[model samples]
Structure formats: structure tokens, C-alpha cells
Target: MKPTEQIESTLDHVNMYSTPSDLKITDIRFTDIYGAPMHCSLMKIYTNSELVGFGEVRDAASKTYALMVKDRILGENPCNIDKIFRRIKQFGWHGRQSGGVCGIEVALWDIAGKAYGIPVYQMLGGKFRDKIRMYCDTDIDPHLSGVEAGQRVKQRLEKGYTLVKFDLGIGLLADVEGALCAPLGFLDQMKAYPPEVLFHSRATDEASRALRNKVYDLHNIAHPFTGIRITEKGLDYLEQYAAEVRSAVGYHVPLAIDHIGHIGVEDCIKLAQRLDKYTFAWLEDLVPWQYTDQYVHISRACQTPICTGEDIYLKENFLPLLQSRGVSVIHPDILTCGGILECKKIGDLAQDYEVAMAIHMAESPIACMAAVHTAAATENFLALEFHSEDVPWWSDLVCGLPHPIVQQGYIAVPDTPGLGIKALNDDVIAEHIHPGIPGQWEATEAWNNEWSHDRLWS
Candidate 1:
């Protein structure tokens, strides 16, 4: 339980990496493939040895996010995972940008697992559960008729998801009076954005407000600044949708709600209190997790459980929230939040505070496998997220997985080495590459030469 145990492991732990301390990272390259919700990227770290390791960056992020760390990790022993993580952890930050370090960490662990002939969970510690319980997520059209909503609940029930989440955003109030200030004020900024982001932007006008509207750049937006207020009338309208969904799903299942929009803490608290009758699994990301005080206020004010941390990076950043009991549950995205061991570390820390840990995942199979390993090892883990249950090709993204990747709402913890995925189906990836993005993975030789001194502390 000491910090040394996490960063430094004993020889008795797994004994897989002991034999291959000589394997060094020869090259690191990535492939971009389209996935549910957004385009996803992954790291393919080639070592001096033939055993390769694969890791995924969070969905909707750039592949270059991981490639930026190539200079730091090159020539390092891939098997010395924690030591390599320490050398490059300085390059990581608190959001999706941290994907670089996370991708590298997962890959290093994978390589070590393969080199040492063990599974990742064995290296982490030992398993707590044989299978990880998955919570399924899907979007809703608030305008659906009663019959339609009921039909949806029945369909999802047939699919065998025990825990469910629906998008509970301001869009539910679109046709109501004075419900939304500007519904489509910002439209798909992912396409309109420039090549690079600035530390300071001069877009204080009413027009350059997509970030304020919470339509884009979700990684950086602070919720309080949005000034998006919901009137009591709007609240009542939103509550109608909640009541309908709750009635359909019933209390027996853990029906969670999320994406309430960029509103102030006061509105968030009011809504949480108002919706207390429904008894949600958790109300997620009322704002970013950085506002620990507001989170504590919301946590104390409501009967419904509060959840956050899909955008948080490492265990150190989550400690403040855990110490303050700011939220009842810590939800981390596996690819964005420092991969397998780091998430296990966060889960362990949360256990100390009696806060439950659930993962926030929306990527290809590679990242989900990593999450499965972490969730399997963490005793206090509640659920791992499933965002692409509706995407038809999601399972085919990776080959050699058991058919029906998730069976009856649970994923069997794979017993094979590394993440247990045999390989990415190159043809499936080829079919799904987003337009204008590079379609090939082998052309990243140029990235190997792209280097700079990015060390932050002197």
C-alpha cells in the first residue's frame, strides 16, 4: 500500500519483466482510426525485440498526442515501465493532452506483459473479480413519444445492460419557452477550429462563444463561465424527460444521467435536488472536476450521488477531490487518465476515502481491454463504461476477441498476456479512417525525428 509498492514492484509480483530487461523501445508510431463518437488513435511501440505493444489514446484526440513523447521514451528499456513512466510523467498534463503519457504507459506495460509472459492484471497485483461489470450508455431524443421511449427501454433491456446512462442535456428543452439562449450558436467547432490552440484567446465577444456554449473544446471549458441559466420552467420541462425515462427503466436498474450542460453551480445544485426523487446512479460532470469547492457543495447539497473525472489525468490530481469527499464516485476515462496502473492507483486511493470508482471509456477495443484489466484488479471498482454498444462495427475493430465481446452485460477478464487482443484488423481500421486524416500507420517515421526540449521543471 506504500507509494514504493506502486512505482517499484517486488520480484514475486509477476516475474514477467525480469527476464527481458534488455528489450529497448526502438520506435513509436501511431494509427488513427474512426470510432464511435469520434476518431480514435493508438500507439504501436516497436522494441528492439519482436514483441510489440499497443495502447490507445482517448477517443477524439490526435495521434500526435502520444507521438510527442517519442523523444523521451526512445532507447529506454520498455520493460522498466514505472521508471519509464517517471521519466515522461513530467510531459503529461491534466486533460486529453495527457493521452501521450497514458498511451506510452499502457504500451510499456503491454510489452512487459508479453516479454514476461504474464497478463497485465498479474503485474498490477492480483485479480479482485473474474469479470468486470459494464454500464451501457446511449443518447436519447427528448422529443420521442411515450411509446418510443418505452420501446427504447425494452430494446435496451433485451440487450442485457444492468446499468444505463442517458444524455440529460439542455437539448431536452429545445421547443419549450425561453429554454435555451442559443441552441445551435456553435456548430461542430471541431471542423472550424484552427491548427493550434493559444494559451490566451481574444475571443471575448458574444460570437466567439462556442467554448462558453459548451459545444466545443470541452477539455478546457470551465462550467461557471458559461452563464447558461436554466429557468424553473426549463427545469420542469427537463424533469418531465427524466420522469419518463425513470418510469420506463424503473428503480431496479441503476439509471444514471449526464451532460447537464455548462451551467453555474447554483443551477446544478438546484437540478440535483429537484431530481433527487429519481435516485440516479450518479449525476456526472455537472462541471469539470477542477472546481473542488463547488463539487463539495454539490455533493453535500444533494441526495443523489455526484460523479466526475473523465478529464482528470493522474492520482495526484484526484487526491484533492477524494480528500474533500467532493464527489461520491470518481469516473476516469482509461485512455486519458494514465492507463492501467494509474487508474488502479486512483481506485485504491478512492477506496481509502470510501468513494466508488467507475471508468469513463469511449474508444476502440484496445483501451477497453486495458480498462478491463484495471477494473479486474481494483476491489472498489463499480463499473466500466460501454459507449459504443450501438455501433455495429465496434467489436470488429480488434480481432481475436471472443465473439459477442460483452455477454449479458459482463466482459470476461481475458487470461491471455498483455490486453488479450490478438491484433487490430487492418481492414476494419481502413474502412473507418476519418476523412483527411492520414490513412496509414507506417508513415510516422517523420515523427521519430520531431523532437524538442519540453521539460517543465528546472
Candidate 2:
């Protein structure tokens, strides 16, 4: 389609924003999914009309992620969203879709939006909200008391974040031994052990139930829309944990739960059914996207909203879910779901059904910025998750940005052209560089053992 042809699909596209300027990919950046901090790179895209756009590329921790990125986006037209993704997928065949191809595709759209001199949402369909409401996770230190968690909420409000969520299902079922048994370092261990062994080693019900109450107590004091991210252990004792939390906090605050890599849709439905009395924000990732029909059924049955798609790649991946109306909200991780442009499209589709959107974010500030921009443009955005609360150094990654994207718990839309945030490359390099992973600007040797057995498992 020509630049002026007015092409529109559920797919990612750059519609005219602020008079049509010829758009081209002028730059790229990337982020690493699994390691400390994050990794990213900037690339430049050029167009026949002499317009240039900047793009970003990122990946979760994988051996050949950087090489995989190069394989996909080196010469592709950053403006062509679908074509770029197709190219990335071809190179990403072996890896499936965790981060490599997905990250590069994201940066390309960021570049496209920048090239067009518009916020990504404007290209998607323009935005509905001036500021996107955000919910920060509640304070959870093995050391902190419920009062301390409540104090943190006061502090969070002072910092400007309006909403809060926390790990609610920690130690559940203290009466039952080994009730909560989440694998330690499941990210690294999952690479070594099969799923069954990992499950066997995880927490038991009693312990899981105990920890969950601790988290629930913290949730009890959290303000309304105080969200909860439940671990797999928590989900295991769904009936017990949900009942406890609802009773402890009362129904005034909205309850929410994330799958956290545990419990399929069946379990999600069961949990929702068990807690039907409380007003829930949503049931996140009841199952993976492949179980669309199951998700639909769960949504139909549960009083709680059904949400999924944190790891899904783009709008196309989410359309069937939306069309089925299985989910009440579409949860798109700005990094995983093809970045800002794709996320905006996902939100737009959700808007068609009057379904809301809640962004799933857990990366560094870079990904958060992309999310804020996209969320600013998305009308149906219910809330965006800021996963940086525990990490003090997260926001420093983008210290030079024009204004603080987040204030008083709401993120103001960036008025600048493109993604409207600059990468602190020098700081990024100083903090994130590791041996063989890409020295400075180049991809490094294959990463075989980046993760060691160090951090405690979940």
C-alpha cells in the first residue's frame, strides 16, 4: 500500500499523524529479558522521502538473541510492521517467541511511530486518555510488616502512583507441610529440569497458604484497586487463598491475580468461581493463549474478569481472543507483545468490545517508557503495571528523558515525536555489558552459561 493509501487492519500500521511525513526506520535499541538490568541497541531507519526513524531491539536471556535480532532487522523496512515481523520469525524459528524476534519487531514499530512524528497510539487510532492510570506493586520484603506495607502505600501515593499490587499468595496452608513450593530460580532451573520435577519440588499447600496470608494481610490495607499478583503456589491453594484475601481486605478493593507461570485455565476458572463474591479486577493468564476456548468459558462463568496475552507477540495473536470475547482485558507486555505500536493495536481491538486493557510490564524503564507512550494513546486502558518498585536502579536507566513519564501514579503521554524517550546508551552499556554477550555495539559469542545457580528459586 502507498503511504497515502490509508491502510488499516487489526495489524500494526503507521497511519498519518501530524501531517503525513515519509517514514523510515532510523534507529534501534534492544533489552535483555532474563538478566540483571536489561540490554538494548539503537538502529537508524531511512526512507526515500529522507525521513528517518529510530528503533529499539530487545530480548529475554537466550544464547543467540543478539544474533537472532541481527538476522531479522538488519535491512528490513522498519515502516512495514508485518513484513518486519515475518522476517524476524523466519530467523526466530528455533527460538519460538520469548524475546529475540519479538523484541526487534517492537523496536521497529517504535521507530515507525518516531519516523512519523507521532506517538505510537496516534498511528494505531489516536488515544483516548490523556494520562494512563498506573498501579504499583505493594511493598513485600520478607522483613516488612503489614503496617510497613501500608506505610509503603502512603509512600507510593506520595510518589504519585495511585494503585498498588502485591504478591498475595506467598506461604499458604501452614498446616500442610510443603504447601507452597515454587522452584528456586525457575527461570534458570526450568532450563535444566523438566516441568514435572520442577512442580514436585515447588511449595506445598500449608506453607503456601501461610505465606499467601502474609501477602493478603499486606493486601488488606492497600487502597482500592489494590491489585494482587499471585504466584503458582498461591494458585495451587486457590479456594483457600482467595477466600482469605477477600475476607481480610473486604470487597471494596478490587482483587486481581496473575498466573505467574502456574495454573492452567481450569484452575483459573476454579479460583474465580471460589471467589465469586468479591469484585475482582481480572484473572490474568488463566491459561496460555492456545486455550482460547477455555479462557472464553472461564470468562463466561466467572464474576472476575479474565485477562491473558502477556507473552503474546502482536495484535494478530490477540484478535482471536478478543473476537471470542474470552477475556475482559487484554494484557500486553510492551516488550513481549511487539512493543508500543502492537500494544496500541491490541488495546484498540479491546476497545471495540468495550474490553479494557492492562499492560503487563516487568522490564526496565526503557520498556516502561514504550508502554507509557502506548498506554497514553490507548483509550480502553484500565491500568498499567509498573514492575520497577522493588528495583531502585530501574528508573535511572533513562535519567535523561525530558520529564518524568510517571507522576502521582499516572503517566502523562509523551508529546514528542516517535517514542519520545532517549536511551542512556553510555549508562546502559556501563551497567549491562557482560562478557561474550556483545561488547559495546556488537553481538558477542554465543551465550551458553549466562545464568549460574545463585539466586533463590521462586
Candidate 3:
């Protein structure tokens, strides 16, 4: 073939939507959505080509995390995702701190996908599955009994969810006498406070600062350090709860449990032993993700599978748990665990150690779709979490996908360009915009000039 003919053929197939080589990032802006059950900050990275990529900060995380690094990425090509990710990743740390870096990385991928005219999963070396399995996370009223909880699980099953999770911890025993034995004032401090009081207590006044510090001190106490113990009577009640839930849901489906409270490892082991007969999918976050030794201890003590890692940040930090064979399942929240590619890498690494991977997602559709892409590309994938099944407007926040994203407990991997979202539903979003966060994707010129020497070494 002649060179001229080859050039002409290439031109025929050129993407009219984007000039990948010339796609420079113009700005980064955010809109916070409330009552997706939690406040989720949705990020949009605009490009010179007029294409916008969607990403999301972890639920309840501040948008400032993403805004702080805007200057570092301006004028850079969004297609160079890895190079850009390396530049900003240093700014991210574990937990919600990583939300900024992770969210931006996902947006970059979204742009790259649009530029290349393919789905994000295709760019991640193609997909391993056509549809991503979803696990419904149902949090019933804590005052409800185990039987009621089981009924909730039954509802999820009726909706076609093969895998389901529920909250099963000391929170259930909060009102029950003789259920929990803790240090003086600990239970009182942990009790739920009114929303107005809790919000006002975050003020900068001296009194508010002292009160906030006191609450933090109590909450930050490591699991083992807390002198909370569950008595035999408490154990019996919890066991009965599990029994009723299991009986209602039946043994055919996989049932997972979470939020077992801030109790120590001994209590976790006792509860795990007691509930082993019901055969739970896994006992999640028994202690904390940072306590690799505690997870190892719990895994060894119980027949039930142990799981953790939603609060974990990068894949490197997961090394301790993976190396020690601490947990049977590694649950990475896409937003917290360094976004789409990083979660896929975590899943790949977990597969090396024969560990299953279930994602922990409780954010907007932006983050949900990011997890869906990551799950589609990962080989050790289990199920992605669906936390907003009850939120009627949850799936309406974005367009270009099915009205009900989770059809029969699974989301079909989208083949459309970018994160499969054509555009954000401004009307639906307007209705749910977080009243406290003042603007809706307003111009962020202030962040454009905020500069710092980001280098870590001399």
C-alpha cells in the first residue's frame, strides 16, 4: 500500500469527538449530592475538546481534596493517565484523604476513554466479564430485631440479588439492657446524637473544639484499647438474631455482615464462632484494616471467612494483609483505594494469593460506574456493593445508562465511550444538590493558581 493511501484510510477512521494528542485538561469542578444516603462529591474534569469526564470523591469526603491539586494537572493531556496519576498520587494518603487523587485518576480515565472512542474497561486491557455482579447492602433500623433484618434480606433476594449484606453489630444492642458491657460513659458517648447538635458541634469555638476533641479521642481509640466486652447474654441475643436472619433468607444465598462495632478481637472471635453455623459470606471489618495482626488472629480463630479493606488506600498498603494471608476477601472501595486501575491492580494482586475481591462502594453513580469498570476488568471479582437501592433518584443522577442501573442484581458493563455516561442529569442533580456545599460545578479559578512544591525528596 502507498503511504498516501494509508494516511487517507487512517483519516477515515479518526475520532471526530476528540483529538487525543491535543486533549488538554481545562478545569476541575465538583457538585455535592446529598441523600444518596451520604453526601457524595461528583467531580468533572473538562478538556479543551469540549468533552467532560466524570469522577467522584469518596462519600462524605471533602471536595477540597480534589480541588487542592487542580493546578498540577491543568494544561496536561488527560490521555496520559499514568503520568498524571504519578504526579498527584503523592498528595493522597489512606482513607478519605485518598479520595482526591483517586477521583481525579478516574476522571482522567474517563477522558482517555472518550478520546479513544472506547469504554474504560477496554482501555484497561479488555474486560473479563460482560456484566458485574452486585451485592445489595441493606441497613435496616438498628432497633429492628434479627427477624426483621432477615425479612429485609429476603426482600433483596426477591429483587434478584444472590449476594446481600446487612449491619450486625453492637449498634443493634444499643437499646437492649445487658447486651453490651463497656467502660463508663463509652456507650453514652457512642449513642447517636441529633443532627443539629452534631453539625453545630463542629464549630470553631473553644467549647466546640474541646467537645469535638473529646469525641474524637473516644472514637479514635483502637479496637483492642477499648474496654468493651460482650457478655454471654449479649452473645446469645446476637446469635439468635443471626439465626432468625438466616432462617428467613435461607441457606441458598450468600449473606455478609458488617459494622460489628468497635469491640476488641476477642469479642469478634466469639461472635464469629457463634455465627459460623449460619455460614455468612464474610465477617467484615471485625477490627480495623490497619491491624493486620488482629485480622490474622481472627481469621485463624474462626471458620467463617474474614474481610476488610474499604478504608484502605493504595494497593501497596494492602501488602501487609495480603502477605500475611490475614483475610479471605479483600474489599476495596474504588474511591478510597486509588480509583479504577488501582482497584483492578488490587484485585489482580489478591488473585495471586487466592483471595476473592468484593468492592465497597457507597457513593454516586460516577463512583459506582468506576467500580463497575474495575470489576469488569478484574479476574478475582466477586460483587460490587449497591448501597442506594432505596434512593429513587440515585440512578437518575446520570443519563445514558438504564433507568434502574442494577437490573436483577447486576449491572451490564457499558460499551459506550467514557464511563458510559453521556451526561449528568442537571435537573435530578439540582434537586439533590447538597445545601451546605454552596455551588453546582461553579468555575474554580481560585484552585488554578494554588501552587506548592509537591516533591517529597531533596
lDDT of 1 by residue, 1-458 (tens): 79777755654444443358678888877777665546677668888777789887777676667777787788888888888888777777777788888888888888888886678999899899998898888766677753466467656767888888877766566556677543354322422553232212326676646544543454245667655678888887677777877777677888778878777899999889889998899999998788999999999999999999999988999999999989899998877777788899999999999999999988878888999999999999999898888888888878777877888889999888788877877887788776556655775666666666766659
Candidate 3 per-residue lDDT over residues 309-347, each given as its tens digit? 999988999989999989999999988888888998999
lDDT per model, in order? 0.79, 0.56, 0.88
Best candidate, TM-score? 3
TM-score of each: 0.87, 0.66, 0.95
The whole-model C-alpha lDDT of candidate 1 against the native structure comes to: 0.79
lDDT of 1 at 273: 86
Question: lDDT per residue, candidate 2, 1-458, as tens digits?
Answer: 66545443312333343224334333333323223233334333344444444433443334244344553344456668777665455343211244556555555656666555566667666667777788875535434444444455556656866556654333233223344433344323322433223212225578755654544443233211222234445445645545555555555655466533343445445567766665667666655666778877888887777777776766777888888988888877765676566677788888888888888775555566677777777777888887666555555555445444566777777766566555444564456554334444432323322433332446
How far off is residue 318 in model 3, in Å?
A: 1.0
Runs with alpha carbons beyond 4 Å of true place in candidate 2: 1-59, 63-66, 69-72, 75-77, 80-83, 89-98, 110-117, 138-158, 170-253, 264-267, 399-404, 432-438, 443-458
What is residue 98's positional error in candidate 1, in angstroms? 0.6
In model 3, residue pairs whose N, Cα or C atoms come closer than 3 Å (at least 3 residues apart or on different chains), thus clashing, are none
Q: Best candidate per lDDT, number?
A: 3
Query: Higher-lDDT candidate among 2 and 3?
Result: 3
